[model samples]
Target: MGMSYRRYLYGERVYGCSKCKTHLATIHSMISRAFNGQHGRAYLFESVVNIVEGEPCDRPMTTGNHTVRDIYCIKCNTTLGWKYDKAYEVSQRYKEGKFILERNLLVDVQ
Candidate 1:
């Protein structure tokens, strides 16, 4: 046999896309963000497909006015995460072109 497709675990096993079941990312994919009042700390990412970026916003948060973008599932248009454009203020500086996917946004499939 060959390598079989992998599945993610929640209450049950999942394949991908809560709406479309399209395999996007893997279990190891990590999305971390700060100062989100709703989620409190960091978001999670099972898979990411689409990214919609707009003009820069001037909100003072992580790194102060980090350019924000919208990440979505390419198959079903589910909003998954947001990408930061610049990393001038961050000490790590690796987050300049990274995203933060919400854990709640993902759905488990079989």
Candidate 2:
């Protein structure tokens, strides 16, 4: 028999809009930071998430007037994750360490 090649799709398992999927990397990073004791320390690179063709936001998403170094998805307009200046604040106040790795995000997975 000829070589049977199996196509293996190696990428984010996006169940929602493409924009949300695109920010998987950033989300993962934020989760990692939180796990590592870096809380509320999100960085948003691009401007605030914009309303894309497929994705629409009920209300404008704001970074709480905080400038970060992370990028948001254009499709879903979800605040995937962020690296904020108030890392200490998050570490102290926020009950959760990371935002992306929160239980809510994994509701479908479970």
Candidate 3:
């Protein structure tokens, strides 16, 4: 394997992994706040960094079934959330290629 480089995000509001405080995403990249995760409330993000994704698997969610891959913090290996690969419901298709970061597992690093 090659060396892995972590990206740092600079902005007014930065969300990071609670365990390692690694930069994940900024407020400007946030898509929505009314989402739920395994831990509790979550936020949907247009993009995120400094994380690794696991294999994609089909999971049923409140909106519908989706093919998602669990995302983990690259610095601390903490499971932060998941990334939507495919949405089964047309109404939920907007979430595909987006990411979810649990509020309970995040910290305001900025």
Best by lDDT: 3
Q: Write the per-residue lDDT of candidate 3 for residues 7-80, one digit (tens) a residue.
A: 99999999999998999999999999999999899999999999999999999988989999999999989999
Which portions of model 3 miss their true places by more than 4 Å?
none
Total clashes, candidate 1?
2
TM-score of each: 0.56, 0.26, 0.98
Q: In candidate 2, what are the lDDT values of residues 7-60, reduced to their tens digit?
A: 222234312223333323323232232232123333322222222222222221
Name the lDDT of candidate 2. 0.29
Task: Compose the digit string of candidate 1's lDDT tens values, residues 53-97.
Answer: 445554456445556666656545676556666655758356666
Which 10-residue span in candidate 3 carries the lowest summed lDDT? 101-110
The reply for model 2, stretches above 4 Å from the true place, is 1-23, 26-71, 85-103, 106-110
Q: lDDT winner between 1 and 3, please give it.
A: 3
